[model samples]
Target chain A: MKRNAAAFGAGALFAVGLALSGMTRPAKVVGFLDLAGDWDASLAFVMMGAIAVHFVAYRVVLRRPAPLFDVRFHLPTRKDIDLRLVLGAALFGVGWGLGGYCPGPGLVSAAAGSLGAIVFVVGLTAGMLIEQAVARALPRRE
Target chain B: MHDFTPIPALIGGAIIGLAASLLLLTHGKVAGISGLYGSLLRQGTSDRAFRLWFIAGLAAMGMLVRLTWPAAFASAWSASLPVTLLAGLIVGFGTQLGNGCTSGHGVCGLSRLSVRSLVATLTFMGTGFATVFVVRHLLGGAR
Candidate 1:
């Protein structure tokens, strides 16, 4: 229960941040990306602020031998610059430019009952499910 | 730069960072939305509870925003239905295939100074800029 509570609290804070940053709106996001046109540089500030804080805070948190609730950190250890990563990111970028909604803000916007956000989430879920199904059906290389 | 709001963006971003920090300090977890959301779709996972609660909290905050700040929720992107649907589908597939999205790779992964995330972030941003340019400038914007 406590762990869940912590998760909930963190999620709430994150959502609030997104909202306050004006990132909950697709227009703002797309505007940020539209550098050639009338670009909105607010999102850059958002990224800078987040990176600055997390950059400092992560080191502070890691100094502790263990987290309060877990035995070890669950960090990603992959260091590959493979084709899949590039292709996936390129696809994601197109989607982001097309819809102006990433996973976090998409869910948040969907919660707010935006029709566009709903459509985006549906497509996103379908894509994820399809990938899972295909991966399951295929043979493993490793 | 008519709507270039730096202060609020910075504040909100700091809050997001704080949230990420809290999750790490307490749960030893990365607050990547796609990773958390993806796990919920899977079955027989003991860690499902936290993810569910986290998502629920995100939704609840949206509700709160809707009730309090409706203008903040307003959007400017007015693409057609088919276009929006396709975009969503592509985004979903891309994030999953890549194993992360803006939050996972852009925020959390980059902060950890992961080389893979750096490449992913750059690739996505480059493509995003190009797509927007093509859609808005070359194609004369969305309908």
Candidate 2:
């Protein structure tokens, strides 16, 4: 219960940051990407601020032997660089550039009930289902 | 330059970082939206409870933001249906395929100084910039 509570609060806080930062707006995202055009450099500041705070917070939290509820931290430990990582990120980049909605803002926008955002989410889930099928065929790495 | 908004961007980013920190401190879970949302479609997962609650909270706040700040979604992107759908499908597939997205790889992963996250971040950011350049400059602006 406590863990779920924390997760809920964190998720809400995450939304607050996204909205306040104007990340929920995709045009800002596209503007940030348009280097040759009138570039909106706000995304850089968002990243810089997020990283600066998380840099300190991450180290401080890991000081504990275990997380508050979990027995251990479930950090990603994979070190191998395979074809999947690069290709996947590239594909995601294309999608992001085209749509201006990554997972976080995509979901939020969808929840706010825009037909386009909803359609994007539908396509996204279908894509996930397809990827799941493909992944199942490959040998498990982790 | 005129579009530069360092104030809200920084303040909002710090909030996001704090939220990520809260999730990590309590649940040891990386605050990646793709992973959290993907977990819904996943099976044999014991941690599904928190993921659902997380998304629920996100949705609730989404509506709240709409109420409190209507202007946030006012200038929403108006991509064609095909483009929006294609983007969605590709994003979902790619994030799952890559094992992370902006929040996972961009925020949490980088904070940990993981070399792999660094590589993934660069790959996505590079392609993102390239795609935008082609669409806006060569093809005459996507939206």
Q: Write the per-residue lDDT of candidate 2 for residues B60-99, one digit (tens) a residue.
A: 8988988878776655446788998999999999999998
Please provide TM-scores, in order, for all candidate models, with all chains considered together: 0.97, 0.96
Model 2 C-alpha lDDT per residue in residues A1-142, reported as the tens digit of each score: 8888888899999988888887888788888888888889999888888889998999999999999999999999899888899999899999988888888888887887756778889988998888988888887776
Every candidate's DockQ is 0.83, 0.81
lDDT per residue (tens digit) for residues B45-93 in model 1: 5678888988999999988998999877797676677787888888877
TM-score of 2: 0.96
Ten contiguous residues with the weakest lDDT in model 1 chain A: A133-142
